[model samples]
Target: MSPVLTYVLLVIVMLIWGLNVVALKLLVEAFAPVTMQAVRIFVAGVSLFIVLYFLKDLRWLNKKEWGYTLLATVFGVVGHHSFLALGLAQTSASNAALILGMLPLTTSVLAMIFLHDRMTWLRLLGICCGFIGVAFVVLQNNGGLGTISTGDLFILLAMASQAFSFILIKKVTATLSAGEMTAVMLLAGSVMLFAFSLWVEPHGLDTFSQGSWWIWLVFFASAIIATALGHVLFNMGINKIGAGQAAVFNNLVPFFALVSAFLFLGEPLLLSQIFGFIFIATGVLLGTGYVDEKLKRANLMVHSQSKPPVSIHDQIEAQGQHKAKSDSV
Candidate 1:
């Protein structure tokens, strides 16, 4: 597919993910946070399972693959969403969105550390910008050097968990197709989340039964659109362009979330958040090598053309011919 089309799909995916934050906030008002996550995971996993089954895309995993998937389930599904659910319960969706905008930067750093991915100075600059941007939002909210809020901290933890999980995913996606890997991870995460919900929220499932039909609607949207479809597209995007370039798309999430929050939840977008978004987005753009890639390609072309074409075989033939001509002379 064209890069433009892929990007369009990415925008839709980010919008789904952004609105998902608002959906979570609303859902948790009537449902337990962990319970809501469990249901979302379950529904998303089951939905993927059905689709994979129909497409014959489901593959059996070996012990090693299962192990990696389990690890991913722990970090990506369990830890990431667990903190995110609790954090959203405490913080505003807009705050969470702005904080989460730093995901690409964190993920790039993790990739550099764990995956040994090369980092140019541009990427390094981007990483610094991202941290500064996030700090801007956090410090401003904390009243200039005051302690950060519990919810904000949790959101940061969620970002770290998900970022590290992406590093693990880089390794796993090497062997497993994105769809297969996502399905396995979601299944494991759903089971674990369900168990956690059972232990944490005694009346969790009962809340759903007591809630209105709109709750179910939101739940399904979160499950199918946000969790399942969103993840599928995310993995696909990663597979297409690579993790760094794909992460650049995350900068859109905060903007989308801000708008969604305003329209749906009546949340206000503050100046700090806007500034944070700009810094983080610019940082992510640099960190992802989006522009550097074009320059690199151009430089490669120039360097390749600058070298004279020479083949050892041709040289050898020329030498022989020259010797014969000299002997004739």
Candidate 2:
């Protein structure tokens, strides 16, 4: 696929994900948070399984791989979604989106610490700025740090949990395909959340009114569109243009979320949120190595002095000729 098409798909992925926050906001009004999350994960897992089954590409993970998969499921599915659902119940969807925008920054820091990924001074500054942005959004002109709501705190922790799970993801990549990994994690998460809902919010599933089909609509839509389909498009985009370029598109999530919230939910736009988003986006760009002026200049200089880009076909022919010459020797 062309880069243009890949990026367009990425934009669609962000749009679906942004709207997912709105769906969660609506769903949580009628369903208990844990119950809602459990249902969503169940639906997403089943949907992915069906897609992979028809493609004949699904692979069952072995016992050793399941061990790492279980750890990732705990962090990514259980911990992250638990905190996210709890946070959304207390915070506005718009606020949740803005706070969640710090995900890439959190992932960068965790990768640096755990994976020993290279980090420059610029990245350090970006990390600091990202935290400051989160503070600004959390505090929201309340004049002190005490104003940060419980919801915002939960969202922060949720981001951290997701980030930590990313660290584990690298370890499991060799053992599982992306689809297999996601399916397992979602299945595990669904089981865990379902059990939690039964234990803590037993009456939740019973409380759904007969006429509120809209709630189920939103729930299934989020599962199919945002979670399952979004992951497929995201992986395809990464394959087409590479992960680094694909990641840059993630900054659009909050922008789309803010727009959807304002238009659909009639949420107010706050000056602090705009400022916070700016800093957060800037921080992500720098922290993720997507926008470093020095690196760009260095790359430009190298490209300027290097040979022209080579096509795969041409490279293959050149390699064949070189092998032929070596055979004669």
lDDT of each residue in 275-301, candidate 2, tens digit only: 889999989988876667558788999
RMSD per candidate (Å) reads 4.2, 4.9
Q: How far is candidate 2 from the true structure (C-alpha RMSD, Å)?
A: 4.9
Model 1 C-alpha lDDT per residue in residues 160-210, reported as the tens digit of each score: 998888788878777788787888888889899989889888888888777
Give the number of colliding residue pairs in candidate 1. 0
Clashes of 2: 0
List lDDT for all candidates, in order: 0.84, 0.85
C-alpha lDDT of candidate 1 relative to the true structure: 0.84
What candidate 1 gets wrong by more than 4 Å, as runs, is 142-145, 236-245, 304-329
Cα lDDT, model 2, residue 192: 91
The TM-score between candidate 2 and the true structure equals 0.89
TM-score of each: 0.88, 0.89
